[model samples]
Target: MSWSHLLGQRAALDYLRSAQKSGRAPHGYLFYGPAGVGKRTAAVALAQALLCHQPPEPGEACGACKSCRWIAARNGLLTNHPDLIPLLKNPETEKEKVLGDQEQIIPLDTVLDICARLSKSPMAGPKRVVVIPEAHRMCTGQAEAANAFLKTLEEPPPTSVVILTSSRPEALLETIVSRVQPVRFRRLSAEDIRAGLAQGNAKAQEDEIALAAALADGSLGRAKELLEGDLGRWRTAVMKALERAGPQACPGVGLALWALADAEGKRLFEEAEQKDDEPAADGEDEEGAEAEEEAAAKTESGWKRFVFRRLLDLCEVAFRDALVTAAGAGPDQLLQPDGAKLAQALAQRFGDEGCSRMLEALREAHFATRLYVRGDLVGRMLAGRMVSNLRRGP
Candidate 1:
């Protein structure tokens, strides 16, 4: 794969391509950006170029070459190449549940093992590439696992390069940040996202794509997510819930959001597990079931966290747009222009002051969710506030 294969991220692609042409690719690079802006894609593309047995073009990989083929074929996030090393955080352990770590630390043993592999000569290519797909969680707190891997980052083998990708660069350790070259990946523009969506197989309506683009907040990953997922339905649910909510129905809004997020989370977990494991027999031994249950709980927590957060994000965007609409803004000034009717209804029901207050309530709920508050509670709180702030006055 070549840089040309990845869409958007023109600036970042140019910088890395220049590094390859100049033969000055850094020993360590921190490619940080919002999720789905193409940091991981760049990492894979760059590695392919560096390891390609035959260059199809300058600073580009020959897709037909064995090196390029293996690199494109992924084992989870990492490539299949012998020279590629991935030090990933363990998802099976419920460290977040046990001690509130937010994530399990990258096991020190795994780091040491990868470092040991790096010490040897390159197994197949000119360089041994180290890719950390989640440095935000792994390299946080100056933890033992992070400290153990510091030596490799400080002075990698002459034939090796390290690439760390994270959406939360601020959370990484200063020492970790200082050692590597930094390349910032800005969010893709709306036009870029729209072009990408048009190329996809889903063949969604133009208006739907336009609405998704407006709501996407400049991340193509997020745009694709919103288009493919049930987030749109959740938004509609919120609208209908609030519009028809009486004393009895107000609480149901929160419960509905919670249940919807819970279901989405479960579906995501099941899909991932299916991708990771092949079909097995109907029944499992007690030990196997116990282990599977534990893994499910921990991994599902991460997935559910994202699902719930996305719901809140949609809520925040809708209410923010409603506030502007209430202030007499046109469709151009408001997001969800494709859903102007929904926004218009929201503006009429909430009015100016109510919209502002609901935004505050959503912000508070966002904070509580980050602190790992119960999802049901956050939903209930938001629902109650929306209902209480209701105004049908003349």
Candidate 2:
């Protein structure tokens, strides 16, 4: 729960500590960075320190204290602490929700509720801390939620601090941005991620962890997901499909990729269903069930996109490895070290130009996917292009 436990954010911690020591902690702070890079963790740690019954030093929270324990407690959607308010999107309306899915916008009602809470006196700690983990989702345009929240930011309570965290800070309102102090969180390096995974007791082997870190794009959250999820199995399947795909096998390869995507979508759907079946909290009603369905749909769509993107990344990495191998690169240069021999053989088959062309095709497919292109069509196009590219004369 201490800031020291947050790996790979030394600079951010230093700045926050200095601010605390100077007694100049801002009323509003924006912790902005990529997903899973410790923004929310840092915010929570800061809250604990601010509300700790006996803080040992500046920027340090006594985690064993009653106030800190309540803030850290997690029971369903709500935390045990009354003064520590977390404004997050609610997937189910029936529960006392604190956090939810990647919502499109923070509803106006939620913002008003937050304003009301801030108006009240502290229930336990010396100060109240409002943590908005995804503040960029605050409603814009005619909704007035962002505008409404501005009043609280403009004239914040004397004993309250608002902490806003977002991966997409550019999407936030200009006025809102101006009102808050910005704290930048950088992505963790591969070594940093590897160390963290080890510390977290990840079950993957060292090589597997290294591969995941390389593919994680500097996000610890992504690395952990890659380790715990089906990325390893899917990666193996992709390699096998590439090796088996001949000029006449484009349709078959495309079908295999389609199956993978379909299976992932179904898995996500089932998981959401299971979560829905969990009994609702005290105040939840029938309308909450309807919200759950909507949330499930959104989750499924997002999960599919993530799967497709990862598949595309695997394709890019494979082709890049092949290109490097064809140019007489060493094994250390390979992205997929676990499949080095396979990658080398594929490089011999495709040669330099073929690998380059395949990489370009994969890039185009990735762009198309981002533009909301149908996943099946993209898979088919990628399969056809890989076959055609590999079969062409040098």
Candidate 3:
């Protein structure tokens, strides 16, 4: 019952429970799965069980224990428990080692430091848990950082437990993968997402929860993000704008969407500023200020891309619905039944060929995102391509 809160991860829970009960828990565990599907949650839960003082069973932690409360007391990367270490390189904690999104390579020094700590005795309990989120990042630069950690992973201390979580296990080195116990976490179902949302967010309505679950593509994190950020309303507004635009609605609609995404991103940024609990670092010189400014710019760019991707997802679904409509499918068969009007118009104008071409254009735009292209330029280019494809057809 220690894992009662983890929805859609029964297999992983069962495996961990059995491992704990059998007293055969490995020194290292590789938690592999898609994003936002309770991998981190399970890591913390397992850590709690291992660190608990009075567990009813070997693998299960009492829900009301001191260790459980300490593990649950997490803020950002740091937890209240000293023995539970969450290794993630963020700008706030490790400014010198900050890799950001462009080159997120965990440096060799970080691994050495963790290995040194693990060599010592546990501070709080019998077991020391080290959770490394996005463990695949260590595989970058010809796996330089990964090779550094391989030594410790191969021969870990008896008191230490390393939990490596990665959505892309294929990116990890084979040597490292062979050492750890692999526990797979699959993507959550819609009902799982809905249930998770209902438990965490009390303000969410039934309709919003259902829609978020449907559109999240099995990502509980994204479902919560959609509802929390009200991106659904943003999508509704975009669909409404294209209602009576000129044939194709290319550059105009595209620019409008880019602007909307930008605005929403800024809104989220301000919300973060309001909730910014971390205090500013003192004695910042001119160079430090500039570096902070540069980091801020990168963060803003990330926000734009994130919101734009969500918008593109909605548009893609709408167009996909349009294709179904062109193929004589009714609204019931459409993925986005609420956007039936827009789908009907798009189907009537572009027919099947244009919609297919447009999806290709969307794919190009998505690829552009990966390349760190400006969101506005990508939007305009996508729209221009859509217009050309539509005109060529009819």
**Predictions in order: lDDT:** 0.69, 0.74, 0.73
Which candidate leads in TM-score?
2
Task: Give candidate 2's TM-score.
Answer: 0.86
Q: Compose the digit string of candidate 3's lDDT tens values, residues 312-339.
A: 7777777788889999998988876787
What are the models' TM-scores?
Answer: 0.79, 0.86, 0.84
As a whole number from 0 to 100, the lDDT of residue 335 in candidate 2 is: 84
* Span of ten consecutive residues with least summed lDDT in model 2: 285-294
Global local distance difference test of model 2:
0.74
**Candidate 3 segments whose C-alpha is farther than 4 A from its true place:** 75-82, 86-103, 142-145, 245-248, 277-298, 391-394
Candidate 3, residue 55: Cα displacement in angstroms equals 1.5
Ranking by lDDT: 2, 3, 1
In what order do the candidates fall by TM-score, top score first?
2, 3, 1
Candidate 1 displacement at residue 17 in angstroms: 1.0
The residue-by-residue lDDT of candidate 2 on 1-394, one tens digit each, is 5576577988888998889888888988999988777777788788888888788886678877888776555311335477887564442363356545345567877788788788778887778888786687784454488888998999999988898888788989989999999999998999888887776645678877887788878777777766655777778888888777666765687667766877886686667578669975532211121121122234665556557767777877888898898899888878876677777867877778888998898889878866778888988887788777774654
Off by over 4 Å in 1: 56-58, 75-80, 86-103, 141-143, 200-208, 245-252, 259-309, 331-333, 391-393
